[model samples]
Target: MTETMNNVLNDDKKWKIIQGDCLKVLEGFAPGSFDAVITDPPYASGARTQADKQKSTRQKYSSMGDNAPPAFEGDAKDQRSWTRWAAEWLAEARRIAKPGAPVCMFIDWRQLPAASDALQWAGWIWRGTAVWDKGNSRPQRGRFRQQAEYIVWGSNGDMPISRPVPCLPGVFKYGNPGKRIHLTEKPLQLMRDIVRICEPGGLILDPFAGSGTTVLAGVLEGYRAIGIEVTDVYAILAQERIVRELAEAV
Candidate 1:
């Protein structure tokens, strides 16, 4: 590793959160710097038309009025644009990951297909999709409830069956966080469970660390983690949350 990369990972803590464009920050890492990639990226869904997609993330995803979490960037892309962008980041992430490094990306139903395509287009072996059943959601009269998100998981290449990881579940049942600091923040325990896909004490990366859940979980689970968040507000929030939560856990 380069001097700077080593310094960043060997800091006082086992985790770090970098604030910048993920595409740009991801380029700064050395090849094979990480053992896994686990993240919940902006889905850029919840709308149909291009104009609708351009709405602020809060407007597009929440209805809590002024009480909602702050809006984030990079969620305004249309389908084609989002797919291309996903491919670029996924390719970069794959480059930074070690051989056989596992990757888990969270996405809703709307972008599930595109996410899988991006994962393969970026040269990672396509594994299977896991479900995150929220257990509850606003019920629709005639249609099914949208209570589940997906984790599209795979490996860099040739993940050996002998890798020191446990048998993980295909479906995770967890409710959403009751109090969220980010609009699409995921449940912390869910993140903790997901980070186990990496071998113990391995390093992990989360290119779209909206709230640093993956980074925090990795550290708590005995692995190193690095998170990249583009939005300034969320970058600060994520860092603060991770630090505070880690301190409390200790």
Candidate 2:
């Protein structure tokens, strides 16, 4: 699987997006193969009940009705199951990440506690949380607007303060992209900023490629990156979008 990844990266010197199960694909990497792990995994948190949790990704996330993007996999698990699965993959990601490598995982309020628990269970040093204020969301009659998601960030172990990375903000404000190819696509600029947590030119790993936003952002910011996506439609779509957008920027 890593060899296949290398072949893909050869087509574009700085980045690669592989189509596979991240759990299995991660096993192909050697210990300490990556400098950082940054990804927005499936939150599995858009529902109030277990039955609602099993609804399709599009049904849970999209307000566009029939125009919703294609549904993706791995977002239907219940809370316990999602936490266990998160810990399992996170452990694998840590195994491949260099010592002191930073990790940033995206989650919503419903799963924030679980995500933090899973991170510590996976053996990462729980650093702190960062906010991604989306700037707008549906206002409720009396409750506060659910207008933010969190990045649960940490490190493999003993991240030295001497690292050259900048002092990043604890909060980022960015609206969702006006157009999206995936059900939960992040803004490209948000990803570019997040990738800065890695040292300059370090390789970053994003286990959930979604629309390949992280992979593209990494390259544009002068770092190498690899992304793994399981859904076939998105794997193809991400590759095309990365190739086209990169070419256009040239």
Candidate 3:
């Protein structure tokens, strides 16, 4: 079964979506095996309390587990412990990625400062932050509109640019497709834009490859990619998505 699945993935030219804990899965990879990492890991938003995520979404996960598509896991760590947990896997990702490999990690405004600190703690050079502005944001009476998320991006060491893409702006304005493949499904366009930051035709690693958009973007762009998803159900979905994408391209 494993070999057969591997062959299917290879048909897409080395785009792999593995089902396992990212921290455990990444351990098996040889040091510096990948050129870049563009991923969205679980945001440690709460410690013991569940993140105040949409209750409707939470209900879907609880009602469907295994029988239905996998729900979002992680994201419940408190600010203090979450940083420590993130640092561990981030450092691990660094070990697996080549020096000067670029990394882009996603986070909400609430977790901004801590996440930035985590990246530096993991030995990544803190370059700058990019904004993903979700067009048509929800506005509250007193609070500001909650329409933007951030990408804390940087290089493993020195910034390397063998294949140069046009300079992109710090802010991106795109709207959600309203399709819930995953509760927090990012736009395909967003991933396409971000993948350009990676080395052309180089191997890309997405350790927290929820729904596999990052890996899918890499493969579609002619780059080899490995996406490790902790939830096996989502792993299957991700692999299928990639396969379908590959077929559609042909």
Candidate 4:
């Protein structure tokens, strides 16, 4: 590692959760400094149906958009805009991640194709996708249940030589963690499983660390974690949640 890179990652046992725009914060890191990038960004501010063009797909997912919790900033970009926005940060992520470092992103089915295209456009190889089967999806009368979320994971360059001891499974079957601090709060186990893709001692960066599940996962697994959240409330929430989780573990 270069002197700059070493200085940036001087501590390998810390979890730093900063509140700011990820793209801007990402620019501060040295190139090839991170070992992995695992995150869940807004999917083009979500895909709205024709009937409810005003409301975002995420808003629609919440109960009729009335009692929906406040979504984070930058969740209103259209597909094209989001894809382009994704490329900017993704390119920065690729720049900071080591060669062959893993990149994992979460997106719903509607935005899967666009996300894959964006990842490739950002210069990462489209390795393949994994399924996060929620098992119990909302019931639809005629159409199939929306039971699965897609995870687009790839590598920065060639595959890494350091393999995981027990390979993690691709299809995650973890159930939801029930009530959420964030609208799209993922289960901690899901993030933990994803973090395992990187070596245990390696550093993981999450630009869209809503509620800090990904950062918590990295810290819990002995990997240093750096998370940037634009929303101030969520940034505080993430830190509190991490403390609470660790306290409960003890």
User: Top model by TM-score, which number?
Assistant: 1
- Residues 1-250 of candidate 1 have per-residue lDDT tens digits of 2456646966466889999998988877889989999999899897998899888888998999899999999998888888999999999999989999999999999999999999999999989999999999999899999999999999999999999999999999999999999999999999999999999999999999988999999999999999999999999999999999999999
Off by over 4 Å in 2: 1-12
Clashes of each: 0, 0, 4, 0
lDDT of 2 by residue, 1-250 (tens): 6665444554348888889999999988878889999999999988998899889998999989989989999999989999999999999999989999999999999999999999999999999999999999999998999999999999999999999999999999999999999999999999999999999989999999999999999989989999999999999999999999999989
Model 4 shows how many backbone clashes? 0
> For each candidate, what TM-score against the reference?
0.97, 0.96, 0.86, 0.89
Per-residue lDDT of model 4, residues 1-250, tens digit only? 2463335445533777878998888777778889899999976534465345446534644663656555676766667887999989899999989988999999999889889999999999999999999888779899999899989999998985656636668899988778777778888888888888887688899999889999888888888888889989889999898878866876
Worst 10-residue lDDT window for candidate 4 reads 4-13
lDDT, model 2, position 224: 90
Off by over 4 Å in 4: 1-13, 45-58, 64-69, 161-165
- What TM-score would you give candidate 4 relative to the actual structure? 0.89
lDDT of each: 0.92, 0.93, 0.79, 0.82
